[model samples]
Target: MPRANEPGRTVSSRLWDLLFAFDPNNTELTLADLVRRTGMPHATARRLTLELVEAGALERTSDNRFAIGLPLWRLGTLAPRAETLRRAAQPFVEDLYTALRQHVQLAVLQGDQAVIIERLSAVNAVGLTSQIGGQLPLHCSGVGKVLLSHSTPAFIDDVLAGRLRRFTPRTIVDPAELRGQLASCRSTGTVVVKEELSEGAESVATRIVDGRGKVVAALSVVVAAGSIKLQAAVPSLVASGLGLSRSLGWRPGIPIRTS
Candidate 1:
């Protein structure tokens, strides 16, 4: 039997189920799909869906399909860790992107995923597979590895115990190999991923720290595979990460550590 907190457990949970059903891959749905996805009665789903639409958490498209609303996006912008850190890092990220003429991204750990908070892309740079609000796996992408390296041991173990989807041939699906990669990231304070998330892309990522010297975010620059050497990009990425960290009040002589 399912627990009380399981799917469709309560009205609130059903509402959340309705909301989270929208994702990057499946961003729009009809009311019938919502009922099927949430396992709620049609009338109940209609009521809660309408309530959410009224609350501006979801929107009705011109085709009468529903999707995540602008208000929800605004609410997500209010997340202190994401919004505040993005605001603090924007200028530095912009400068770095301008200098490198590549895709620069800022991301933070949200549960078991790395969520992109902000991104700046060059028109001539490699077409990226990531979106501003998209989530990436912790075992493959550069930003994901940086965030995972800074995460708690328990969280690491939990992720390792779960399914690690292989997005590409280079994606690290084995727990042991991923552990070694995480160790490397901890030792070097940076992560470099090549063709892991996408076949023709490479990412160089570094950690961002707060005044307390704790890792709070990850900064990454993605380029077309083999176009730029990873070693050449590392110094600039590390410097930008430190600059943003300093902007957040992180200073010299403090014991810097990942979260």
Candidate 2:
């Protein structure tokens, strides 16, 4: 709840407030919205917002609203967590997309959510709400299930105990049922989700590991719900996941069924 003009806050702190004001839900903001959210004086907020724009950190849209700019996006890509995994998995993502002509995505576990790092899609792939840097729910999404399967037991218990949102009728809300699914996913290294995240999308996801055999990320191929493509896509999805894992120094000898 702190703002730029607080008695002891620095200019850098103020700048960060402006930067953090934008998120997935609040992608664009007017000058008034910025002032209110950052709790800065009108003139001060306008001044800082304009400075961010000039510095290529914020962009002005056609409607005169502001959004995170391209330069900020470029800088964010340098973040160690996303950069390392993305750089290693991008090629395999593209190859999977090429072979299946579906949408291929790479995601990493972030807190209770799965954050998508890279996505490759064909011109006519099934519509997806997720984009690069966007988040997917852990309970019902393909990548989400894979990442959740590898998370700590306590974390999984906390997640299942919380209010699980239902995106569709197919979304599994029973903790016992979901626990069973998670167990199967952890054992098989792959899962098939049917319209759990969206109405018409199905995702086949698998785990990606590092040399240490630690699960580092998840990869998925998304296609139309009930597409005949599921079976064909599974092998390639698993291979691509394994290939990217090996690139990170993971060995085939390491079993994926580990807790």
Candidate 3:
């Protein structure tokens, strides 16, 4: 593999390295920070960062830091998968939020992780680590489990072969046990998680399918542990997921496809 500052590296690759340095946790960074994070020379980092700012892909902040700019954000919103799913799931998500007054989220599988495409949360709902565009671990989170349950066997095997982080004591790190849970989730189209990802958060999730019966996304509602009956939330969550699926052309007779 080429080093970060290898002479043969392309300008676009360097620019991408700088941009990819900014993530959910480190959303803002100074020029020096970018240089350190990208392992690029100070001059190279500064030049590319300035070019990005000039191109409206990044913006400088009052404190001399940089953040993702509106133009780049607008470009991300144009992603067909997330945008279309969000639009189709909006009404159902809103209804679920109003009916349950909890944290509702819609997520899609991106590689081995579940990326939240849309989310609605009540002011007093349980605290959560994920936000829109944030990711969740497939073995531990409710939405992650639902998405993982419908994934291809090879993909599932690969994910299981990787290291599974134990976020909490309740998180299922044993591949065999987790695999059994996934099998049940695949059969039922829903899974209830209790403080598996976060200490005080519990979630109920269901799969969302599309016209070809492909499992495209997962819809979930998160609440404080033991605050409300997890089972009670299932009906509404599953209904909302099914409703969103129907809007995307899924029907009763269509067999669910795993990708």
Candidate 4:
């Protein structure tokens, strides 16, 4: 177990780690797995896990396993940044999905990861590993790159200093190359990712601005790699992003800067 006064140590933080350990790929966990993953004693893990279950943060399965509960997912809907923005952007996102018949996604920066707040899927669009509430790395994903490009200078430097995991052969790991790409995104108001995160998925993303012209979120359309022209998708993506931004009180006169 971590010491109480250790840097960034807290009961709530540990609790969150326990919660995040559950994912779509690993929805069920045994007590021993929880204990090992959290590095907490079996007794402590059981007690805390029981507490989370009582609080409706985790659900107990018929087989005695634990998974993330719907209550926690509902609580995430209450986040103002997500609730308000997603609600306002839903119609526009839907329209874009209808027009393009592709995977439309809305994302925002949460720490160093891009969290998918909302997504509209076409019946036969390119398959994506990401889902609602799933996270994507900031260096290789379309929405991630757009969100990171608009982040603070310190944050940019910190992300560059950290490990830049290569998801595919085309993933950009060089800081200088990524810096140039971000600069181009800042000027063009869009980021086109070609098979960076997934082997055969491509995404075109644009930044959504708020009333103050701050890039609050990113909107993207994922398509099959090399099948669709990225430039052809830019206009629709930009229009949808701007429409959502306008719904958030962004005006045309304000200059929207990217990175």
Best by TM-score: 3
lDDT of each: 0.87, 0.89, 0.92, 0.87
When summed lDDT is taken over every stretch of 10 residues in candidate 3, the lowest stretch is 224-233
lDDT of 4 by residue, 68-129 (tens): 88898799788998888889988999899888888999999999999999999987888776
Model 2 C-alpha lDDT per residue in residues 1-259, reported as the tens digit of each score: 5546787888788889988888888999999998888888899889989999999999999999999999998998789879978888878988888899999998988888999999988889888777888999999999999999998898899999998999998899999999999999998888999988788888899999988888888999999987799889999999999899999999989755333
For each candidate in turn, the TM-score is 0.89, 0.86, 0.95, 0.88
Off by over 4 Å in 4: 1-10, 257-259
Q: Rank the candidates by TM-score, best first.
A: 3, 1, 4, 2
Whichever of 2 and 3 has more lDDT, that candidate is 3
Question: Measured by TM-score, how close is model 1 to the native structure?
Answer: 0.89
- Model 1, range 79-160, lDDT digits (tens) per residue? 8987888889989998898778788999999888999999999888888767888888888889999999988898899999
Model 1 has an lDDT value of: 0.87
Clashing pairs in 1: none
Q: After superposition, how far is residue 227 of candidate 3 from its true place, in Å?
A: 3.1
What tens-digit string does per-residue lDDT give for candidate 3 at 1-259? 5667988899999999999999999999999889998899999999999999999999988998999999998998899889978988899999999999999999999988999999999988888767999999999999999999999999999999999999999999999999999999999899999999999889999999999999999999998897755777889888888889999999999998888
Candidate 1 deviant stretches above 4 angstroms: 1-8
